[model samples]
Target chain A: MIVGDLSRRELADRLAGEGLALQFGPFNLRIRSNLGSFASLAHQLYEPYPLPEPAAISDFHVDISAPRGLRRWLRRQACFGIDGQLPFAPYTIEHAFPALEWGINWCVATRAHHLLLLHSAAVERNGRAIVFPASPGDGKSTLCTALIHSGWRLLSDEFGIVRPEDGMLLPIPRLIPLKNQSIEVIRKFRPEAIIGPSFLETRKGTVAHVRPPVESIRRAQEPARPRWLVFPRWVAGAPFTLEAMPKSQAFLSVATNAFNYEVLDEIAFRLVTEMVRSCDAYSLVYSDLDDAVNALDKLSQASDG
Target chain B: MLVSPLADRLIWQEWDDIYIVYQPAAAATHVFNETTVLILKCLQQGPLSMEVLRHQTEAALGVSQDELAANDFEFATTRLEELGLVEFVDDPSTAQ
Candidate 1:
């Protein structure tokens, strides 16, 4: 049964007990959290994801619970637990969803070394994926959310998992976290976009998550061959420009942006080299989302032809 | 004379003139330009003196020994050593 099939009470009961196993891209995560806000957000946001059967093996098991010690009673907070260890400090109860989101990303980034994990956004169209490897504040997620709403499938918003054996990009398809002004930008860009409540004064500054499209969630298992690697940066009032990036520069950019590039070592190098070699690399700067999306659409078409 | 060794677990790939070396033992990847890679390739054979490396690199790349700056070669070798790509080793002949 899909996660949407469970009633909110049922979902909460399962989460508060043995946990709820949900399929996320290629991995199945068993999440246990008693945080009421997290449960509500899951019911609202993860409506399209399939629920893993009771007997399914989970790749990572995590829990979110009330923090203990003097801080628990003094200023009540939530702590994320992974395999009996708390990897991060507690956050206020209002920021539970972001904490959970980040915790899941941490799990994949730190433990999943079998695949090359890039700190980037990935989207697919016409059976080909485009990877955006950029430093923070580069407007990757904003552009990614725009493209997804414009018809591209969201492969991932934070991590791009590339399988070394076949050079395929795995889809994580989780929430697209929007920070600060980008949240308002996306909200206005796509009026129908369902974004979670914004958590202000957090580490990332007014962070919210845009729910993944149902189609993306349904097609999470399908991997796409990478066709383009674009390093995008948004500058206000700037004319859109797309420039070719040298393969050598692209190689270093990708390696530097990868989360587990060092851990995967030889395989990571081979895979990233193959990826940069096969795809057209570019540096994209744009102010308008529509213009940016249109340029990418044309590029994808040119690639096909 | 400077002599260094390439790690055993390294896997090398060439893109144009750039070389990408993947060191599996350390789980680290390093990119080297053609000159740096050529020097490393020479070191892969065995330890070589600085003078020997100069002549070998000059011959391998068809460049004049006079045109090859000694400081640049020394700097590159030192950088490679810093990256753990190569290490100084005692020459058996020198010991004898």
Candidate 2:
């Protein structure tokens, strides 16, 4: 069963009561929200993901609700809490869905110590994956979004969940939030893309999200062995340029860019060491999506040959 | 200065001129640049006076001793000392 199977009223009833349990890649997430806006958008966007069994255990239990008392009427806000703990402050009601999106990232970044989690984007092609570990505003999401839309499979848009036992990247294809100018860039680029409502003037300026392709959502359980590590940066008016990066330099960048590398320590060290040794690394600067995608395609194709 | 017992327990890998050493005592991985790598390699040969270590490091780097300041050698050794990876057996404060 999927979210789409449930009618609007049925989904609302479930959310208003217990929660809606859904499988997101490797984990089961049980989401509860009193905000009707969040439910509607969630239903529309998460339609492709499968529903978890009612008896199965959930990895995360989160809730988003409008606070009661004067604040509800004075200025509406949506609060995200997990297991009775509020991780961050409330978002204005208009940004309720975006709040839910960011809340999911917070949960994984803070928890999931069992996996070597990286602040990165992972995309796959022909069993080979490229992990782009980068800081925010470095065009990680933009490049990931473009690649996934341009025939590459979206392993993940935000979290690079690396299984420590083996260096394979576990797929956790979630929504890609395109901020400000990139929103129009993607909208014009991929008309067929399923996009959620734009939340304007929130924390990240005007923001919109592009849904993960249905195929990626359906094939969420499949993990890919990484073959490349590309750090992408968006440079306006600059031509597409890809330079080979040293494995040692790549190792340092990946270790520092990870969300919890120090917490995992030795295990993290071994995984990164092994991963960097096996994969080719590059630094990419680009302005145009078409040219960038072509260059990446050529890179993978050369490796395949 | 001689490498400490903790330094002997270091888990590390070298790629080209770069080396990343993980000190189990500090639970910290240190990434050493070329000069630090040269200094570490020189110290790995056994205990040496500051003058000897500096000469060996400069020789390996192919830079004349009179040209470059021995700052990197001082920096690397100072860092190694702070991390308990090395210790001064002869009180280098008195050394020129």
Candidate 3:
């Protein structure tokens, strides 16, 4: 049954007790939370996700709840726990949603070593993927949001999971978290974009999440051949420009941004080398969202020509 | 004296001017720029002494002898050793 099949109260009850099992691409996550706000948001935000069969084993068993101690009495705070160990300290209850989102990301980035995990935003068009490997605050999510809405399919906003055996980019179409001013920027740029509640004054300043387009979620199982490796940067007042990047530099950028490049060792090395060799790599700098998306569209079109 | 690359543990691939090396002994991957690729290629074709290695790499990369400083050669040798790619060996006759 899909997660939406559960009533809000039923979802809350299950989350407070056993957990809600949902699939994200190749991985299964069993999320347990007693926080009503988190549960309600999960119901809405994760509605597109499929509920795995009851007997399926979850790859990560995650929880976000109040710690049992003085903090719970002093000020209700939420802590993220994976398999009973808390990796992050508690934040105010209001930050529960972002905490949950980040907790899952941590689970994937830290554990998934067999696959080449890149810190990138990926989108697809015409069965080919364009990977944007960049550090946080490089405006990747904003660019990703614009592209997905402008006709491209979102593979992922935080991770570009490459299946090593086949060299295909797996789709993990989860919610894209928009931080600070980008939230308002995306909202004004695409008023139709569905944004979740904002959590103020956290570590990343004000933050909100935009739901993955329903089409992206619907096509989440489809893997795309990587055709372009573009490093995108959003510079203030800069005109849109795309420059061809040397494959050597592209290799370094990807190696540096990869989460498990070293852990995967030779497999990671060959995978990245082949990816750079296969793709038309570029470094893109742009200020206008429309221009950035157009530049990417042209790059995607280059695959045909 | 001939220097041999650590053949048992080291693996590498080249793309254009870039080469990525994987050393199973260290379970690490190292990327070499064009210049480093030239240096490594010289080392790969049987091991040569620091002097011979530097001369061959310079000839291959079009780098003049004066441009290739002693410290630069030492740095590359040390880096390759650290990556488990190359190592210095005493002359066989001298050892006997």
- Higher-ranked by lDDT: 1 or 3: 1
lDDT of 3 by residue, B45-68 (tens): 677876788889889879787578
Model 3, residue A169: distance off in Å is 0.8
| Model 1 residue B73 distance off true place after TM-score fit, in angstroms | 2.2
Task: Give per-residue CA lDDT, model 1, range B38-78, as digits (tens).
Answer: 88777778778877877787777779876678888888888
Record all residue pairs in model 3 with backbone atoms less than 3 Å apart, i.e. clashing: B3-B47
TM-score of chain A of 2: 0.98
lDDT of 2 by residue, A160-252 (tens): 889998989999988899898888888887888878888999888988999988889888999999999999999899988999999889999
Docking quality of model 2: it rates as medium
Q: Which predicted model would earn the best lDDT?
A: 1
Report how far off residue A294 is in candidate 2 (Å). Answer: 0.6
- The CAPRI class of candidate 1 is medium
Q: Candidate 3, residue A294: CA error in Å? A: 1.0
- The full ranking of all candidates by DockQ, starting with the best, is 3, 2, 1
Q: Whole-model lDDT for model 1 versus the true structure?
A: 0.88
List, residue by residue over A220-270, the lDDT tens digit for candidate 3. Answer: 889999999989999999988899998878988998899998888878888
